[model samples]
Target: MTATVQPTLDGTTPPAPVDYETWLAAVWPHFIAAAASGRTFTCYSIADTNQLPDPPNPRAHWGRLMHQLRDDGYTRPAGWTCSDRPTTRHSGVRTWKGTAAAQREAAA
Candidate 1:
């Protein structure tokens, strides 16, 4: 999913629309920007004179997307937080730790 461009059947048309953001989650950051959503899929070939491959063009926008995701990290599912880092405050760092723990224990 990192690559948005679909593999080509021949050498011209691309495949169905596959949202790159939703597709590549495993290699995403915790926070993504609105600008990242505007990117779309395109295709490129690896070989200089040989035919292009299907479903994974190295020259397509998808390739760039994957490069961006892999290099910078783009969180998936539109709003899914990046899995690599902790977004919320750590549990032990809370000032009211005892009270929070008591409340959680009582609720349980």
Candidate 2:
């Protein structure tokens, strides 16, 4: 039997309990494995992250990731900016391509 769709009066469900930064890091390997299996996922950005429980401030992980990117010479210098480019088809129809062939396909 189909379950009844009981609409909430206040229109809210319980918040997800995942610790956002830890959740992000823990799932990183899954995202990477998906790539090896010919799928991928979009990434989170510092600006778009949600607030988290206090102490150790949850955004620290993202901060470290950016620092590593900078240290690995993958970022710009002198007050530049970047994007959270989606690298997966599963993220729905949103953006165009990033690289050469992907751009061609998105255009075509």
Candidate 3:
């Protein structure tokens, strides 16, 4: 039987909780993996990355993951300048690219 769709008291369904372990898993969707790989060669604007790599990824919800990856040395900024585009957390977003370490990680 199909489940009936129901709206919540707030007229919206609550967001599903993130499975942190799964989100952190090495094996991700091809798009996410590809984006990570692409970063090694080119920079991507975070604002434009809202629907990146095609197919979709959890990054749309957990944008901070990109910053985490950068902090971990998996990615780096294209430059010191903030993007002209706006974001939820910041007035302007930044561009990022994969680092050599990320390339090696992707290769593995």
Candidate 4:
């Protein structure tokens, strides 16, 4: 069964949820570029802070994007954690680094 997406704060219907793979395709280039450049950034930064265009439902979209990145072999460095600020999603927000394979794919 499909899940219903709740409306945004302004009462407009939220964008339909895209499957992880589909969403990943749209955003992986950004991740791969960051990774290739040896940057470490948080999903929270990309989502909540307007790093990318703020999706209609950033919390769900970025949360899943980060999860799928890990599953797809993106690496996270040691001793890093997400912001501890109260409004943040969670402390588990991981810092991701790019992999050679991802870089190649992005460059293609």
Candidate 5:
């Protein structure tokens, strides 16, 4: 069945979604770079800054990515802050900070 697309909360059209694995691979490097920067950031901020493709299931995929990064020792939950995503209307969001491993990865 075809999935219905919904307009973002800001009334803008969302980017067309891509295959889950392909999208993940494409965005992983950018996210690693963001983590290595050693600055607190939100998932959307990294994705927006990198112009990464949207995942097939945004809600699930984004969270999954963050958790995977944490599990992989690249990032940690830093804190909470207002989201900068245009579609989110400044709602509260979780922030992440890079770990030493991420910094080392970037250097290598």
Candidate 6:
């Protein structure tokens, strides 16, 4: 059976959910750019800054994306800070900074 997207109260259909790999491919470059800035950042901050599309499963996939980036030598944990996401009520979140590899990628 095919699943249908329901229209919201405003009568607009929501965007189709993107699979993890597709969403990651779309947003990776933006994340890399943010990482290359060499400033600490939260996942939400980068998403908001770049207006990235939400992942299919935000609660899990977002963290997965960060871990993948770290594993790829693009970013590293810098410290913890309160999230700037309006809906997050300023909860403590881990922050990341660009690694040397990210700088090299940016320079290339």
Best by TM-score: 6
Summarize candidate 5's per-residue lDDT along 10-103 as a digit string, tens digits. 9998877568888888999988988999999999988887787778888799999999999999999999999988888999999999998899
Model 4 residue pairs with clashes = none
Q: Model 6, 93: alpha-carbon shift in Å?
A: 0.6
- Arrange candidates, best TM-score first: 6, 5, 4, 3, 2, 1
Better of 2 and 3 by TM-score: 3
What tens-digit string does per-residue lDDT give for candidate 3 at 15-104? 544455554453234324544565432223432453433212554634556666667776676644444434434345455677777678
lDDT (10s digit) by residue, model 1, range 1-108: 485565577766665644544444422321132223333211121111123222234236444553464354332222222222144343221010112332343345
Task: Locate the minimum summed-lDDT window of 10 residues in model 2.
Answer: 93-102
Cα error, residue 73 of model 1, in Å, equals 7.8
| lDDT by residue for model 2 (1-108), tens | 975555568876644456655665654443233223322222343222433222234446545544443354333122322345354334432111123333343345
* Clashing residue pairs, backbone N/CA/C < 3 A, model 1: 4-62, 7-54, 7-55, 29-73, 29-74, 30-82, 42-60, 43-60, 44-59, 44-60
Cα lDDT computed for each candidate against the true fold? 0.32, 0.38, 0.51, 0.63, 0.90, 0.91
Candidate 5 RMSD to the correct structure: 5.5
Per-candidate Cα RMSD to the true structure, in Å, reads: 18.2, 13.2, 7.0, 5.4, 5.5, 1.6
Select the stronger candidate by lDDT from 3 and 5.
5
Candidate 3 Cα errors over 4 Å, as ranges: 1-35, 40-63, 80-92
The TM-scores of all predictions, comma-separated, are: 0.19, 0.26, 0.43, 0.51, 0.80, 0.88
Compared with the true structure, model 2 gives a TM-score of 0.26
Please give the distance, in angstroms, between residue 20's alpha carbon in candidate 4 and its true position after superposition. 6.5
lDDT of prediction 3? 0.51
Error of 1 at 52 (Å): 17
Instruction: Report the C-alpha lDDT of model 6 over 7-106, residue by residue, as the tens digit.
Output: 9999999887778999999999988998898888999988998888889998899999999999999999999999999998999999999998888878
The TM-score of predicted model 6 comes to 0.88
Which residue pairs show collisions in model 5? none
Predicted candidate 4 versus true structure: per-residue lDDT over 4-105, tens digit per residue: 788889999966656656666777667656666556676655544434554446667666666667677764543468575467665665677766666676
Model 5 TM? 0.80
